[model samples]
Target: MAMVFADPEMLDRLAKSLDSKAGAIPQLKSRASALDAGDHVSGLPAIASWLGDTAKDLRRRANILRSPSESPFDSLAAFGLPPGVAGDPDAGKKFQTELKAILEAQKNGTPQQRAQAVKDYFATLSPAQQAALAATDPLLVGNLDGVPVNVRYAANRITIQTEYTKEAAYLATLKPTDGAYKRTQERVDTLRSFLNPRIKSYEDPKTGQDMKIEVSRQFLVFDPHFGSTADAKSSPFPDGRIAEVVGDLENADNVAFRVPGITNRLDNFNGFTNGGYQLAADPNGNERPDSAVVSWLGYDTPELGDSVDPAKAFAGGAALNAFRQGISVNLKPNAGLDIFAHSYGTLVTSKALQAGLTNVDNVTFMGSPGLGPNINSVADFKMPNTKFFAMRAPGDWVSYTQGHGKDPADFKDITRLGTDGASGHSQYYDPSTGSLANMRRIFYGGDAKPLTFTHTSLDDEQIGAAEAREMVGFLHSKVPPEIVVKMGGDLDAAVQAHFAGRTGVKDLLLEVHSVLGKYNMLDRVPPDEMFGKINDLAGNVAYKQTYKAVKDKGAPDFVAAAAGKAAELASEKLLGAVTWPVVKLLEVDRIANDAKQFGEIIDRGTAEIGGHVRELGTELGREGAQIYNDTKELSEGLFKDGGKVVLELGDTVIRPWNAGQNAADIWKIGDDAKDKIFAKVPDIAGGLNDVKNTVVDKGGDIARSAAETGGKALDKGIDIGKGVVKFFGG
Candidate 1:
């Protein structure tokens, strides 16, 4: 019933303070009832709200203070009937009379007087009336009527009591526990064996331990509709195909399982003709003696390159769903599993993970065409601790030309796949060579050393190597040597330097030409043609230029005479060369000073020539003897200690490379034109000899005089620059 608050201001303040706008009207009524009954201070609106409708919802939900036999509020917020109404409108007069009685108790009374008045009013009701009143007003049955008129003022009269049930109360209750569930599972497993039987176990010949054991609940070859096999007695799935695989898994632990792609077989519950176990076998029937492998032919699909039927989609999902359901139910606490999915099997693995069915440690995709369009985040897949790895070999046709929708990383975002230059489609199992080492790192985890391939095939050793490499990756091993060599400091610098020097070789050839011509050795070519040949040869030295030889366009007699003067120039140059022969003297001094250095230079140069010969893929012919004789004659002459004849031979053979380049360009000009170029080599060396001996024999007097004169002339040139600057004074 609505109990109006006597103080409007107090009601307003209590409503604002509690932030309970919905409960404000009811709270005001509760405050008025308490004050009218002389049970609380009317002035304390905040405290009244706590004991009013605001608290009603809280108390109903707790049900702590409710009598065991009475109904609590319908909802936490339910309270008494509205103000101005009771059980019926005709009873308003009766409600008013009752209200006045409660209001009259607060005035002119002791604490005991008010308390007794409240108790006597409640005591007036008969047991039947009390029962009816209790249903409508639960607070009345709990002695709430006689809360002391001065209860807020009396510490001694106020009483509080509580009751608690003992351990026996909750002990009778029920909930599930791990122990019971596991025990129940044990019973179910025992019962399953009666229906399904062990089909086979792959044993290791060396260790004699069953690596992968298979079992089927039924041995029936079901129809495409999953109906009974023609031979009911010999079906693969006795209880069910999925159930038998679940039994095998529950019994053993494995590092990884290979799920093979499509192969047609009917009535074999697991699609026997093409399955995981069959695919893992060495194609040539060679056993992988080093490791255990299983080709999982569990996936259902049409043969490779065959179009998919709409009806089979549901079957595919169902088969995967069955395996997932079984694995989830029987997951061992400590064991982790790896799955190798090749080709169409990748699709199955992808679905299983996406559906949250399989709990796998790592998943590898080999020879995969596609997974899905987008698998960007970890949340996109269903399993935990799952690693997605794939490999494509160099010779794999698919790798060479399969259309990539975008850049590899972007394609990964779109297709949810990953590929590296080293990891793209290729051989994943042939350890003899190729990407198997890299795949091994992704799977088994191990170190990769020098791997040599004799034949291209993905065999057991290669598979073992790839798995081992994957194992090493798991262990965080060091990278391979080839990677180190390509990326490291010393080798990188050497490669750069070697290439740069090669580019400069042609320039050095041109520099030798200028030095030869400075000694009046212009007989190297007919004067008119020398300039044209220089430009022609320079073109051939680099791709930026194309060399074209000038034909014999009828040379003038003067040009022919210049070309024919080679012998005269060689003789005249020899007179000067003989007077100053320090090049010959120094050669003698070096050969006498150190025989070991001489031997090493000769050995190293020969080795360098040998390597170049091998690279050109050439063979020595009859002309080889001429080259050997030229080399021996030159070496013997240069090796001598101070002989004029040897010195002369050494100079002719060691002509400037630039002059030789010019000579080569013009050698086809004519017979006399070629001889003049050959004759210029000795002319240049003989001229240097004339000057060397002139200074040597005279105790360096002539050289000293010339140096002093040159210094004076250079000083005079500096004075001239200063004079010119002053003459133009600003």
Candidate 2:
């Protein structure tokens, strides 16, 4: 039947508009029957409903052409209908007309009545008619709550295929500036992303022509304009995927309805579907009759930058009914129902609950900011016998933002599922997480005990700190003490190797950090704690370059010579705020002033060695390295105050020649080749020899002892990066 314009003014305008084009068709205007009765052309119903408002309004402005319902119009501007559907005007009208009867029947009905009326109408459709409708306006039929679950699934898939065809064609014609072009492109890209991964397995890349992978989950809802309704006005075009179910919703014994959070779209639809599918398959093999997990993107999620309005959920809040009704349609008498709400999805779910959910037994919320103002208690939801469950991963960062309201988990009544550090806001569905285990248990009307993972309430903590602590606890829990011990031993070996000239210690820092990053520990650990542990465990100063022998005739001269050589180099900066005295004492320019300060400390060390019958530099030994190395306090005095190791013993190596009063008696400081000549002080020659021997045994061992340890440190340092990359994926 032709639609009657309700406004008298609109009716008059339409009549004149049709009359203006009267000259083109001679016989139709003179028909004795009413316009609605005789308007059918070429076996099609009247084209008035098919002629969209856009073209109809255009006719009022000027001359416009109308086409027969059965004939394709070549000149009409693009409309929402597919080109095939638009051209073949009778294409989906039969289905549309049948559905319209229900819509008309429920027009003045209450919300509940309207919903029931739609469902009843669907119950009366024949299988052939249902199939036709699924092929025609599948988006409408599939998402409508009253439709049977299997029918909804079929309709949605058809809708997706059709939309994919239309959008693919539209993409080829879009210009850079076309309205919603980016959105259209994104829609296409998202669909491709989902479809591309469905190839389960392929021949090995090296052996086969191409590698293959599998599409693991079934996508149930892929509408781009789900939350958008045009009751009074138009909505944005090319909005994204409203939902995707990983399994068949119509035939399963258990159903999980998942709600997504902010900034999700069709592009992100598949990325998020794994959680739902994984939950179904995780602890329990898909052995049970569980139907499928529904990833409900049924609402418009605000961008992160948008203000956190509790009412923001109202946009797609009605989807909760869709969720409730879907399960009602196809679920068996004994089937179970579970709803999982995540992030901003909690807000939408909360609103749905407030309106009263039916046929739902368990409603679980994870990573919820809040429940919104209206729902203070589970009773506020008014879901009589329905139980509420909330689970926040011990380390999920989303817990810090309470935009929705107070968390459901906090209430004694709402069961909070426990999760470990491995599951962040996005990882709730990963099989590796405890949360997934709990979700699976709850879905089957069973009990799940949550891990007592530590968590900082959002109240006295910043998001970073809360995550950091969770990380510390989570990582500590995941890595067994034995592993840490083994790692610690490896790090110690690395330090030894670095000092022995096998590898650099600097690489150790980067490698360990990379490992933590691979573990996703970087987001959870505090910078200080992370760096501190890395420094303490893996970081060590390689004294290979710092320790050196000073050759001199006697112990006193060897000590002075070592100190003099130390004074010959410029100041060197080490890790943190540390600087060795060799860096300060070795400056050739500052040697004169530097020596006086270093000389006093040298006297103290030499005095200590002098009393102990230390050696002269017979064979430049580690004793000589330690002899001057011991003058840390004096060396520190020479370095600037800001140095971290002002007086720390990160001694540098420099050789000094003692050009005493007798040039013949001079000794080359660092060279073991330098012949010691303390003939002028032969009285202590025996003592000098003894000291030299002691120094040779001790100091030499410290300086260039074994490179074996350094080789290990070096190998470990290099392996750290490789190990972590491999751990995450190389």
- Cα deviation at 560, candidate 1, in Å, is 42
TM-scores, all models, native as reference: 0.25, 0.46
Which digits, one per residue and each the tens of the lDDT, describe model 2 over residues 1-113? 01011233444476666554443343553452346555444322233334344345645423311111111121111111123333343556686787888878777765556
Estimate the Cα RMSD of every predicted model relative to the unseen true structure.
43.6, 32.4
State candidate 1's TM-score: 0.25
Put down candidate 1 lDDT per residue, 254-362, tens digits, no spaces: 3345554433223232332223333223332232332333333334553322312212223454455443333332333444566666555555555566555455666
Name the candidate that leads on TM-score: 2
List candidate 1 stretches off by more than 4 Å: 1-248, 266-296, 304-318, 328-331, 376-384, 395-730
**Residue 681, candidate 1: C-alpha displacement in angstroms:** 99
Lowest-sum lDDT 10-residue window in model 1 = 155-164
